[model samples]
Target: MNFLPITKQEMLERGIEQPDFVYVIGDAYVDHPSFGPAIISRLLESRGYSVCMLPQPDWKRKESVQEFGEPRLGFLVSAGNMDSMVNHYTVGKKRRRTDAYSPGGISGLRPDRAAVVYSNLIRQTYKKTPIILGGIEASLRRMAHYDYWSDQVRASVLMDSGGDLISYGMGEHSVLAIAEALAAGIPVNEITYIPGTVYRTKEMDSVYQGVCLPDYQEICRSKEAYARSVALQYENTDPVTGKTLIESYGTKGCIVQNPPAAPLTIQEMDDIYDLPYMRTYHPSYEKMGKIPAIEEIKFSLTSNRGCFGGCSFCALTFHQGRQVQVRSHASILREAENCRRDPEFKGYIHDVGGPTADFRHPSCEKQLSKGVCTNRQCLFPKPCGNLKADHEDYLQLLRKLRELPGIKKVFIRSGIRFDYVTADKDPRFLEEVAMYHVSGQLRVAPEHVSKPVLDAMGKPGHEVYLSFLKQFQTANRKAGKKQYAVPYFMSSHPGCTMKDAVKLAEYVRDLGFMPEQVQDFYPTPATISTCMYYTGLDPRTMKKIYVPRDPREKEMQRALIQYRDPKNYELVKKALELAGRRDLIGYGPKCLIKPGKGEQVSPGMQKKSRKKTIRNVHKKKGR
Candidate 1:
């Protein structure tokens, strides 16, 4: 019912001499399950351990970390919910105007490389205090990985941050285990044996049966080696089938990653979500303004925690693993009921799913016992034959939420795997979602239309998307609703050529759809797509691929997605020429854009530029 203490006085008011953990985060203090710091702090508090939240502490001064002094056990550092670089800068490496995670939606609140910065800041004040890194930044960067901003392979965050350990992935199980070990007076250096953690050590004698990856220097020297390392890491993501991975940092030390912690059971998932969360930003920020991130999730319910869709561009496989762990219907209903009780409740539940919304259980029953297959995906290339592809449980859950009092609409705002929908034998789930869950337009990610590009992105083919679109329209018509399917597409992905970009633009023109926003491929750390972007080699297959890294080319690819816009006319025209599709640049029905005056057209082209007269010009000017 109460927010965790953020100030020393607040801690003292709660009668704590010193907190068991001082959680230093790079985001504003928002005590919601959606925020990692909130969950860890609340979970610790539930376990009789006091925690003081130190959010967005000033990295310029060491005294900022000295606010609550040293903790009884250690300092937990996280770069909030997102990686600091990604939060601060856009895919084009331009600084963003605002930060959704900061108070008042302001920018420049947290330093770049926040986990490393915050951890170093803490080390300045308390030299010997154990600093344990967590959250997306630390989790994905727990090894020597590619850094897009710097264009170099960086060391493990555990080494750079001077942190004793990294509790990677969804750290509920590992963090709790770490707390118990620390509380038992175990030294931080001796806590390497814990699962779902990474630590550095000089001696590898004790590392039993660990898989030795190429040294940091080796990967830094050879892109092929780096690609090989990424492939190895990808294969060992399954907790049940993973092995202890060790990587040498030359004379500095070797970083060892313990096998991931086992996926949470249904009861454990329920218990974690059931934790008492104030579920909003700290009240002290009433004047500063609202935390923008909370608004999206305040009324939402997280029904599941893992994804098996195996999208190459996504970091879910490395972070949350491939196993899908979900909460019981009762637990989700309880959370939804609480949302309804809030004064801000507007008879709408914003979302009711997790990483992949409709995934209610493990992809296959065998996943519950043996874990997902490392070699093949459940719903990539094609859905595995063993894939259950059931939606009845999820459908029932949605039905119950809709029937709840004071709830007029319960939306599925999260991304749903359309391929999975097509794979299911039962059509009721798609029909019901189109009829009830969609808010006029249902959002889905087709990513790209080109086979080579979609293959590189590890997404379903255009045919699959086409089939789903037909089904969606049919369902909407049957239900007497006029909903639309808003398919999301990405640009500049590896293996995508100007020809492919033109193809996509032609598709957009034919459909008469202009996307308001487009995602340009960003090479964040630890993703298979990022690996391809960096090495020009597919980590999965080691095949050489074409990668577009020039900013201008990337811009043209992005502009192709919104070719209808006036601002993108020049870029779209340029892209069409480069793709050898000059025929698509005139007054023809299939043309992406009309040829402007003075623009040259290829000889024998069906669509050609025409000279505009004085009368035509005056007409355009409304004369």
Candidate 2:
């Protein structure tokens, strides 16, 4: 129930002369399931490998990385749960001031591109110690990708980090395979055969029947080529049908990603979650007031993994893949009972789900063996005829947890696939959620209400959200609940124009909810929408797409979502006028803003006189 050694003295106390592996992470060492390195290390320790953790080593000094010295097996590098650049910067490309994963809620603990920095630091010290890359940062960048902060296509992270190999995806199986391979005295360079791993090689012969992606040079020279390459990479993510993919990095080298490993079975998944997790940030971080990232998951349980919702902006398809896997009810109940033992337990279980809360299996039985379709999604456009929409199992799981002793409330805080919920004929699931699960407001991601934008984003049309909203309201009404649906909307997504923004504004207006926040489509690595944002070509169809790239336009798109806000009045007015829909500028139920008054001030924007804008002043006077 204690954490692995993070210092040489602790390792010596544990009677270890030299560790089998040194896990270098960009996050504070939290031995919880939510942290990737913790699971892999614990799982390896479970298999009898001595592991030590080096959390957020100072990349500026080689001495910091050599804290544990060279390990017998290798050095494992990860940039933590989130991509480092994403963690350190806002979508506006401004440096973030706080890092939740770091001790004391501080930023700047980990360098940007932390995996690459840490790995190279290891290379500087122990040149040939089988530097291995894993976790979200390495997983998403294992192949050629568009680096947002750099605003250019970059080569695989393994190349930059000097990592001998990379264990991609949820790497319980592949990471263990790597440890076993190294333990058997296999040369690090020759260990490219492991599925869920990426390795660079000179001989293509070693990669049997691998799909050759567009060469790095070609993909970089042409955006269309990069789009084509990304599409191919996504097509091969399915474990059932994926093949090894090889990308040439010039005449001297090639990076080969073996087919993704098959998902773990229920018992295997159960065992993984049941590992000896201390279930909190390492006690070393106690003085830092706890790692902020551990707060949500300290008592929350992850019931499943993998996402089939298939939002184009999401990177889950490349990382966790779409094959849903779950733990047994007994396993979950056992964990819930354990939660009750903690002195901090407050008669509630924060969450009991994973990437998608309701998914306990693949979308359909065929997906189990046939894999998710590469060209289309399971739920978008509309649910496929073969979609298994029943939530009976999930409902039963919820009911079982609800009945557990000392558990007063079991909430579903994770994303619930509303489309999946409405697709089911049974109303009992919705009724149950309305009655018990929602914490006053249920969060759902509609992303955007524009049809074309929704289509480009791999999300269902606006009507799907509307349908779910109506059903949710009816359910809450029947249950005598006053719950609300806080739909998440994204602005400035590819194919979303000012007109689309206006459409979304109209929809939000009718709903009488001016959202406090909106996500400007962040072009993170390895997402179809990111591809479109960069390449202006839909990877699925290669058709030309529109991207709201100009900062002002992106701002306007965001402002339109909250057009009712006095602060947003100027920006919304400008957006309406720019889109040639000036009719929306007048004071009418259909109008988004009032006509220009005394000072000809813009709506949805603040005036710079250090005083309230005309709209704000008008709003204050109860206009």
**Best of the candidates, lDDT:** 1
Model 1 stretches with alpha carbons more than 4 Å out: 602-623
lDDT per residue for candidate 2 within 88-156, as digits (tens), equals 999999999999999999999999999899988888878788998999999999999998899999999
lDDT of 1 at 228: 95
Candidate 1's residue-wise lDDT over 462-567, tens digit each? 9999999999999999899998888788999999999999888878887788988799999998999999999999989999999999999999999999998999
Where does candidate 1 have its weakest 10-residue lDDT segment?
604-613
What are the Cα lDDT values of the candidates?
0.92, 0.89
Winner by TM-score:
1
Q: What is the lDDT of residue 411 in candidate 1?
A: 92
Query: What does the lDDT come to for candidate 2?
Result: 0.89
The alpha-carbon deviation from the true structure for residue 238 of candidate 1, after best TM-score superposition, in angstroms, is 0.8
* Candidate 1, position 6, lDDT: 92
TM-score (C-alpha, index-matched) for candidate 1 = 0.97
